[model samples]
Target: MQRRGLLLILSSPSGAGKSTLARRLMGWDPTIRFSVSATTRAPRPGEEDGREYYFRSRAQFEAMIADQQMLEHAEVFGNLYGSPRGPVEAAMAEGRDTLFDIDWQGGQQIRNSALGRDVVSVFVLPPSIAELDRRLRGRAQDSEEVIAGRMAKSRDEISHWAEYDYVLVNDDIDRSFKQLQTILEAERMRRDRQPALTDFVRGLNREFEQR
Candidate 1:
């Protein structure tokens, strides 16, 4: 039986390396498709439209929310961001694995949708608070006050780790990525993942009965 794709949702606090691992997973596996989100936030200096994010107007975003076009919508850091339902549903129906890098609220929206069991959610965590702080400092992008704000948010984000099906500690990139790959591979092999497995098993039962 051909394996129907499973939804892989990876989320993490700031500097936990979920994005890095997700990128690696996509690069190594052609079957995995990314779920690009739409946002009302303006593109950063070199960010491109559609590729980095599907930049939309606030009105358009609100309209989608009104019409139930969005799987989930939330305001983060004063900017509106959300995952659209159409493309994600299309990919899953065609047996392509859709990867969603979303927060707990976004994931809840998916869970409430009809495609819930198709999901296999994982959350990534940093090794330690001090290590997370050091990594944030190393970036040299945020001011001390800004860093403090992010640190505060990080605690909030990490608090939701128990909500995910899988939790990974990203102490070492290579090791952590391997662990993620293992998780995907393991999920892929589950009996329920093969949409036709039931029919196949029933056919085997018929053959045995006839014999």
Candidate 2:
């Protein structure tokens, strides 16, 4: 029997390189399906619906929340961001891993839901605070005041490192992504996590008795 996929949750502070890592990991592995979240925010230039996010209205977002349809959601900088429950379930049912590029609070919500056991969480970190600040400013999209606020938020995000099952310090992108890939590989093979493997173990007994 094929094993069900792991729900991989990769979280990090802003400018910690999670988005790059996620794209690289998904590109390297075909078995994983990246979970595109639903958002109530307007799309940026070049952003597409369903590719970037399922951009929704406040009413729709509120309705999803009211009906408990979202797997997890949070308000980031006054914008509503959340994961839809249906798409994740459909992907996992097909034995494909679901990648969630979200924060720790979102991870906590999923863990509290039925989907909790499917999750394997990884938290990414920057090499240093100075590097983090530099990376954020390198984007050049924000004002100095906005950049300062993000830096402050970064500290708060990093403080939750202990909540994750694994943590990776990203000094280098390629190396850190490889480390993340290795973690995914190991997680997929965990015995207790793969209940489907128990059937194979049972089959060994039949072969032994025949011998």
Candidate 3:
């Protein structure tokens, strides 16, 4: 049956393993397209322009927002980040599933848009608040000050867990990945997503009549 694609939205607090799980998912299925975001923030070291983000000047990004080119946009830490509506729609039209690593706010906006039905939101949670802090400290990529700031925001992020269709506690990466995969597989199997199923059922009916 011809199948339509899903817009998979994976969100979690800063220290959660959403990024790692996203990588594993893409590795599991190469056809899953990663939604590249547009950002007004300057690219970091070793980051490519279009590969990491579609880097834009503040003026350009604002222009896109004004023109309604962004599917979901938000400001964080004084930087503006958003997903472009055009590319996402194009990917959906081509039957390619797009994966988004966005926060709950962006998730809400996307799910409220015209393409809302195509979205499947998942929220990943840490096993515990203490464990969440531990994971953040383990990364060592951010300063202690930054970690503290993130910790303060963790509760806020976790509060919206129920908004997602699926909620996973990322206590163990392996198990979490398995659950994530199962969710995707099940969502893909939903009857509405398989547009060709109508024809297949009709064929079966005709064959039964001939018999």
| Candidate 3: tens digits of C-alpha lDDT, residues 1-211 | 5588889999999879999999999999998999999999999999998889999999999999999999999998899999999888787777778999999899999999988999999999999999998888887878889887888888898999999999999899999999999999999999988988999999999999999
Q: Please, what is the whole-model Cα lDDT of each candidate in the order they appear?
A: 0.88, 0.89, 0.92
Deviating ranges (above 4 Å) for candidate 2: 209-211
Model 3 TM-score, 2 decimals: 0.92
In model 2, which range of ten residues has the least summed lDDT? Answer: 188-197
- Clashes by residue pair, model 2: none
Better of 2 and 3 by TM-score: 3
The sequence of per-residue lDDT tens digits that candidate 2 reaches over residues 1-211 is 5667778999999899999999998889877888899999999999999999999998999899999889999998788999998878888778779999988899889878898888899999999999998899889888889998888888888888998889999999989988998999898887756777888889998899999
Model 3 bad stretches (over 4 Å): 141-143, 205-211
For model 1, what is the alpha-carbon lDDT of residue 19? 84
